[model samples]
Target: MIEFTNWDILRNLLLAARWTIALSLTAFIGGTIVGLLLTAMRLSGRRPLQWLVRGYVELFQGTPLLMQLFLVFFGLSLLGFDISAWAAAAFALTFFTSAFLTEIWRGCIDTLPRGQWEASRCLGLNFKQTLSRVILPQAVRVALAPTVGFSVQVVKGTALASIIGFVELTKAGTMLNNATFEPFKIFAMVALIYFALCYPLSLASQRLEKKFNGSR
Candidate 1:
C-alpha cells in the first residue's frame, strides 16, 4: 500500500474540487437556458407545445439521474457521437436540472394572482410581452428562493458524475483511498469538503427565501 500523507491527499482532493464547482456551474447555466425555453413552451398557447414540454420534463424528472447519465454516456456512443464522460455527465446533469427548474419556476409563475393575467390582457400586452414585462418581473421574486435552493442540489449532483469515471472530488477520494488504504480518513475529508461547498449555498438560499417572503 502506498503511504499517503494527509496533506498530499487533501491537496489532490482540493484540486479535484475545482472540477466539481466547474461541473455544477456548467450544469446550472446550461440548465437555466433549457429550463427557460421549456417553461415558455409548457406555458405556450399551443396545446401540442405544452404537451411536448410536459413530456420532456416528465421524462427527465421522472427517471433516475444515474440512468440519464448512462444513457447519455453509453447510449450516445452507440449513436456514433463520441463523448467524453465529462461531456456526457455535464449534458445529463444539465437536462436533469432543467426538468426540475422548469417545474419549480412554473409553480412560481402559477402563483401569480389570476388578476395579473387579466390585467395584462386588458392593457394590450400579448402573451410574450406580458410574460416578459409584467408576470415574470413579479414571479421572479417567488422564483429566486427556489432557484437558489436548486443550485445546492446541482452541486451535490456533481458527485454522481464519479460513477462514470469522471475525476471530480468524489472520484479523486475513491482513487486516493484505494491507493492509501485509508477509506475512513479519506471519506471523512471528502464529506467535509462537500459540506464546505454546499453549506454556504444552503444558507444563502434560506436567507433569500426569507427576504423574498418577508418582502411580501
Candidate 2:
C-alpha cells in the first residue's frame, strides 16, 4: 500500500467533492426542467396525461435509488447503450429528483384555495392562463421552502453514485481507505464533509419555511 499523508487524502477527497457538487447541480437543474413538464402534465386534467405522469413518479419514487443507478449504469450497457458512470448517475438522479419534485410541486398546487381556480374561470381565463397568472404565482410561495429542502436530499443522494463507479466524494473515500486502510478516519472526514455541504441548505430551508409561513 502507498503511504498517504492526511492532507493528501483530504485534498483528494476535496477534489472529488467537486464532482459531487457538479453532479448534484446537473441532476437538480435537469430534474427541475423535467419536473416542470411533468407538473404541467399532471395539472392539465387530462386523464391520459395524468396517468402517465403518475406512473413516472411512482416508478421512480416507489423504487430504491440504488436499484435505479444499477439499471441505468449496467442495464443500459447490456442493451448496447455504452453509458458511462457519469451519464448513468446523472440520468438516474435526474429522474429520481424529478419524481419527488413533481410530487412536491403538485402538492403545493393542490394546497391553493379551490376558489382561485374558479375565480380565474369566472374571469374568462382558460386553464393555461389561470395556471400561469393565478395558480403558479401563488403555489410558488408554498413551494420554495420545500424545494430548497429537497436539495439537501439530492446532495446526499449523490453518494449512491459511487456504487456505479462514479468517482465522487464517497467513492474517493473508499479508494483512499483501500489505499491507507483507515476506514474510521477516512469515513469520519467523509461524513463531516457531507454535513458541511448539507447543513447550510438544511438551515436555509428552515429559514425559508419560517419566512414564507410568517408571510402567509
Candidate 3:
C-alpha cells in the first residue's frame, strides 16, 4: 500500500509518454506512405496488383495486432533478423496502421463523384494525373477527419508496444506500479496522460469534419 506522490508519478509518465509519442509518429508516417502505395495498387487496373493489395489489407486487418506484434518480434528473430523490440514493434504497428488507413482512404476516394473521373479523362489526364490532380484533391477533404481521428488510435496503440518491451508509457506505468505497489494510482495517471494526448486530436478532427462538411 505504498503511497504515490503526484510529481514523481507525473514525471515518470511524461518520460514514458515520449516513447509513446515517438512510436505513434513513426507508425503513422511509415504507414501513411505504405498506405498510399497500397491505395494506388488497389485502384490500379492490373488484376494481380489489385489482388495483391487486397490480400495485404485483409491479412493485416484480419489478424489481431497482438499476434502481429508477436510474429514480428518472435517470428522475425526466428528468421535471423536480430531485430530489437523497438524495431519489431514499430514494424508491426506500421503494417497494422497501413491496412486500416488504406481501407479508410479507399472509402474516401470512392466517395468522389464519378463525374470527377470522367471529367479528368475528358481533359486528357492519364490515370496518374486524374488521381493526383482531380480525385485525390477532393478525396483528401473527405479523408482528413478520419485520418486525424485515426491518429488517436495510433497514439493509444502504443500501449501494445509495452508488451513487446518497447518501454513506452504503459511499460513505464507497469514498472512504477511494480516498484511502488500502487497499481491504481499508476494506471489512473497513465489513462489521464493518454486522454490528454488524444482529446485535442479528437476535437480537432471533429472540427475539421464539420468545416469540411459545411464546405461541401
- Models 1 onward score TM values of 0.98, 0.98, 0.96
- The 10-residue segment of model 2 with minimum total lDDT is 207-216
> What would the per-residue lDDT of candidate 3 be over residues 1-216, giving only the tens digit for each residue?
566687888898999899999999999999999999999998888999999989999999899899999999999999999999899989999999999999999999988889998988888999999988888888999999999999998899889989988899999999898979878888999999999999999999999999899486
17-89 per-residue lDDT for model 2 (tens digits) = 9999999999999999999999999999999999999999999999999999999898999999999999999
Residue-level lDDT for 24 in candidate 2: 97
Clashes of each: 0, 0, 0
Q: Which stretches of candidate 3 lie over 4 Å from their true place?
A: 1-4, 214-216
How well does model 2 score by local distance difference test? 0.96
Residue pairs that clash (backbone atoms under 3 angstroms), model 1:
none
C-alpha positional error of residue 151 in candidate 2 after TM-score superposition, expressed in Å? 0.8
Task: Quantify all predictions' global Cα lDDT against the true fold.
Answer: 0.94, 0.96, 0.92
Compose the digit string of candidate 1's lDDT tens values, residues 85-145.
9999999999999999999999999989899999989999899999999888988999998
Tell me the lDDT of candidate 1.
Answer: 0.94
What TM-score, to 2 decimals, does candidate 1 have? 0.98
Instruction: Give per-residue lDDT, candidate 2, residue 29.
Output: 99
